[model samples]
Each structure stands twice: as structure tokens, then as C-alpha cells.
Target: MALTQQQRVELSSLVGDRRVDAVVAGRARMVLWRDEGRSAEEVAALAGVSRPTVNTWVRRYHDHGVPGLADRPRPGKPAEVPGSVRARILALTRMAPPAVTGLTHWSSRELANYLARHEETRVSHNFIADLWRQHGLAPHRSGTFKLSRDPAFADKVVDIVGLYLNPPDGAVVLCVDEKTQVQALDRTQPLLPIDFDRTEKRTHDYVRHGTTNLFAALNTATGTVTARCFPKRRGAEFLTFMKTIAAAYPGRELHVVVDNLSTHTTDEVKTWLADNPRIVFHFTPTGSSWLNMVEIWFGIITRQAIRRGTFTSVTRLTRAINDYVTAWNTDAKPFVWTATPSEILTKVRWVHTEVRKLLTNNDK
Candidate 1:
């Protein structure tokens, strides 16, 4: 729906400013009241503004017309780092480490020094940082972020999310991932097991008995979790896990969403997939295991079932974990995620440039 007359005037004057100016905002109501079918008092009450404020907007509109209600031009010193300086900074950053310039890695201080001496523009490290920030460049932390380059990334993303949002009419949607090296530990102090009144558990500190890999699948529609303990989580083990999923849902085409682990996409596995069309594999974007619902299930297992529990052997650890998973399945329910694809993509875009900074120093 289009905005109301009152809303338009208020928005124009408040666009650059963070908050609405009460007086200027009230004038919007006055302007609305003068429209073909509204009385001044009625418009004031409807717009939740005082009559004087309403009258002001109407009077200003009459005097200056459309641009009258717009915000005044904001005043500030023009940027010292003009277009030429910004272009030079970007160009320098994209070049090799400053060995040619008789220096080492481009530190903030060094870059600022070079700019003032060589480019004839003296600027502080903070100013250089701010300029780089405005362009979303931060080489110091550039490698920490990642993005996908799949040609069919968008379609694949929609398909993956759709499995959770609206699965096939009859089949179940399972989000799956592996949790590796889950250390079985006893805390430094034992936790007393709590009853219905409390959730704390008794524990005694014990040396960690190595680690176990957990393969988990969460039914998104039901919130039920099915887990398995494996010797080691390699491609062969992953193939076995896939077989388990197939057997679990006999005669049904199981839609499985997994991460981009190298083993998960090996040639043998791809051959198996080709041979069995019923099992569909949807991969999440690279470096986004957080998007997998099975990760959340792992957290629950850690908090409610595993932490502080004393286990001396793999058998006992396996039994305790199985008990927890069984109980969880009986009471499982789907998690609510309302984050829109647009919202996620917007956040990704904001970090895209900073992520690209790592590409600058090395052409290869």
C-alpha cells in the first residue's frame, strides 16, 4: 500500500535525520487536513499531531510547494580525501607488498606516511581507516569471511530453504551435519544431579577418553533428531551415514541438506548418488554450517546430556548419547526461523567488500 498524505510529508523531512522533528512532523497532519476530504481537527486527531503543527505543514506547502517540507541540506567540511586520493589508495592497496616502494607490509601508519609524502596529501591513520571503512576495506581481517560462488547458488539456496519451509507433500525434510571430536569430559568439580526442581547434574572430573564423531539428522518438520556414533567421520563413514538415512526412510525419497565437506562430494559418493535417485543432496553455502539445523541439535545434546558427565569408555559414552537422542526424538519439534532470504543476502552484501580485501594484496 502507498503511504498516507501525512506519512509522506513526515518521511521527506525525516529522511536524513534519525528521528522525526515533532513540529515539522505535526505539519504533515496539517497538510493532510487540507486535502480534498478532511477537516483540520479530524486530520490532527487522525495524524496524532497538534493542530498548530498540522497548520504549519499546510502553510509551508502553500508557500514553497512540494520541496517545502523536505529536509534542509546538512553542512560539513568537504572530505579531505577527495576522489583522486581515494582512487590512489585503492590502487596502492591492490598492488604487491610495498617492497618496490622500499617498505614491507602496508601498515596503516606506513600507508598514511606514503600518502602524505608521495601523493602530497597528509592524512591520519584514522582518516585512512575511515576512508577504507567507507569502501568496506579491512585487509587485517579480510580472510575471516567467505561467500559462495556456485553458478546456481540462488536457485540452490531457495530449494534448500524450501525443503524446510514447505517440504514435499508426504516426505520428511532433514537437515544433517557431522559433529566431530566431541570430548567426553568430567568437570574439575562434580555437579549434583538435580530433580524436577533443577537441571544441574552430579559429575566428577576425569581424564578425557579421546573423542567420538556424531552424525546427526534433524527432521525440520517434526524437530525429532536421529543420531549415530561413528569411529571416525570420513567420506566412507559419511557414505555409511547416507545408507542409514536411506534405510530409516524406506521407499521414500529422503531430502538431505549437508555441508560441503570434501568427502561428502567424492566421486564414489557421486556414483552412489547417481545409482540411487531417491536420495537428494542439497549443500549449504560454503562456511555456513550455522545455517544447518543439526548444529542446534548438537548444542542441545551438549547442554542437557553430555556436559560434566563422567565417561571412562566409548561404550558408556555411546549409551548415554543414544539415551539422550531417543528422549529428544520423542519430544522434538521444529525450530522457528523467520529470517528472510533478503535479510540474509543484505547482511552478506555488507561484508562482501571487506571479504574481497584479501584478494587485493595477492593477484594470484
Candidate 2:
């Protein structure tokens, strides 16, 4: 085949370019080799392709130039469901199932059946599943959220986030909270130890030995926890825990973050705060105890130490907790808070707007 100087350069570039498809590059190589006086069989052997493939590409290049080396659209059947039908299917998936159907959410098979019966749209469950996967829709899954109705929600968020991101110098910021009613459960049977192919298993049923409450103070600067277990989660116990925390870090200003639990704001607690000139309490917004960093530590301890523990008695449970706390303090690192108050409030506002839109649509 005869070739222009530009075509020769393009084919040579395609053969040497790393980004070009291997098959395209091979085709380009065969055309180049054929132009360089190589026979069809030699080019086929060099390109690891049949002589027919080499001849086909050489013929295509002679007719159409370098673009002929690329792939062509293969013939296939058209789509069964139109765009309108797919849109309707997605819209219905977003809605709660009709009361008559007695379904909380729409399953793929249920959606397919519903569409066939009511909308006169025939689609297989597998097709519906594929459509959902392509669009990243999951009608079967639900997530939970709570909008804080606290009048001072913004102020509290700013205050807490400020403390997290920029604490006052010469003062210790402590996220204080109580993890109440931590059960000391004893399994009815011995825990089956894990093997090479088996997970560690325990009995479903357990004896309730007792329950204890943990009052924790997480130091935001150093991640050290001052924690104690109490028989009851009362104002007096909280006061005692506060005193212990004070004694732990003497002569330092303490800003303690706590939830708006009744026990946390009792008259006794108020009097103690008044007496302690160095300590101040900052209450998290209502229903927003997640702001307390100690809650993160609580989750860590629950998963690591308490959740699967065989505690025959409360003492054993408390001992296990203390042991874990000691081990944790030995090499403690602070949990870094990254989100700013503005970022959090912006997301919250977006959620609120979406919720309002949903409610308005439901009313219609």
C-alpha cells in the first residue's frame, strides 16, 4: 500500500505511544510493516494475528486512512425500556409503597410486578436491579437523621466547634458525658474460640449480672480520659466524678462539655459549679450528644472491651473497663476534629431544606 508522510508518522506514533490501544497499535504496526516490504504472513507472525486480520486492516487503511485502525460499533438489539419508563420506575422507587401493598420499601421484583400490573410496563427484576445500580439508587436502604430543635443550635454549634478547633490557651477542654446502664452480661455457655475457618461465637442468651454507669472526661489536648464507674448515674455521682477530674488536673482552668441531661444540670451540680471558680460547663444542644468527644471513646471501649466480655459480676466488668482505660492512657492520641461550624451548619441547613421539600411534596 502507498502512504502519505503524515499517515506514516501517525502510524509510527501509534505503534510507539504507550497510551494507544494495544490492538490499534498492532494494526498500525502491521500496516507500517506491509509498507516496509514485509509479506502478509510475516506481518501476521510479527503482530501475533491471523493473515486475514492483517489483510483486512491493510485493506481498511488503504481505503480510509489511520481512523480505520480503531474499533467499529458492533450491531446489537435496541433497549427494551425507553427513557420515560426508566424515569417513572426511578420516581416510583423513591416513593413509599402504597398502603394496599403493605410494603415499607420497594424491592426489585415488587417494583417490576407493580409496573407491569399498574403502569403497563413490562420489565424483569434483573433489569430493574441493573437500572438501580447504574443510577446509584437503593430503595431498600434507609438512613436516620435528627434535626436539632434547640433554639440556640447555631450558637451551641459555634461554641463547641470553636473549642474543638481552637481551644483557649492555659485551659483544658474536656468533653464529659455518661455512658449509662452498661450491662454486665454473662453468656449462658462458654464462648466458642475462633479457628482457622470459624469465627468466635457466643450464646445468644446471657444472664444480666448487673449494670454500671461510666462517667468519662476526655481531655481534648492530650486524649487522656479521667473515667470512673458508678452504681447509679445521679447528680451526686456526676459531682463526684467532676471532683475527681478536678483533682486529676489541679490548678488548671477546665471547660467541660456535657449534654443537657437533667442529672447534669441538677441544683447540686449548679452549686458545685458555683463553688469551683476554675471550672465551667458547656452544654451541648438538645438531642446533640454526638458533639461530645467522649462518646467516640465510649464507642471504642464498647467495641474493644465490653461488648463481648464475659462479665459474671459488675466488679469484673468495672475491672475490665479500668484495665482498658489504663492501657489506652499509656499511649493515648487525641481525636482530631476537622469540620468547621460553618461547614456543619451548611450541611444541616441543606438537610432541613430537603426535609421541608419532602414534607411539602407529601402534603400535595
What are the lDDT figures for the candidates, one per model?
A: 0.66, 0.80
lDDT of 2 by residue, 202-262 (tens): 3355788899999899999999988899999899999999999999889999999999999
lDDT of 2: 0.80
Candidate 2 residue 169 Cα shift, in angstroms, is 0.7
The C-alpha RMSD of each candidate to the native structure, in angstroms, is 17.9, 17.0
TM-score, per-candidate, Cα-based: 0.53, 0.60
Give per-residue CA lDDT, model 1, range 291-362, as digits (tens): 677877776777677764777777788889999888887877788656556665665665556435534533
At residue 298, candidate 2 shows an lDDT of 89
Task: Give the range where candidate 2 is weakest over 10 consecutive residues by summed lDDT.
Answer: 192-201
Reference-based TM-score, model 1: 0.53
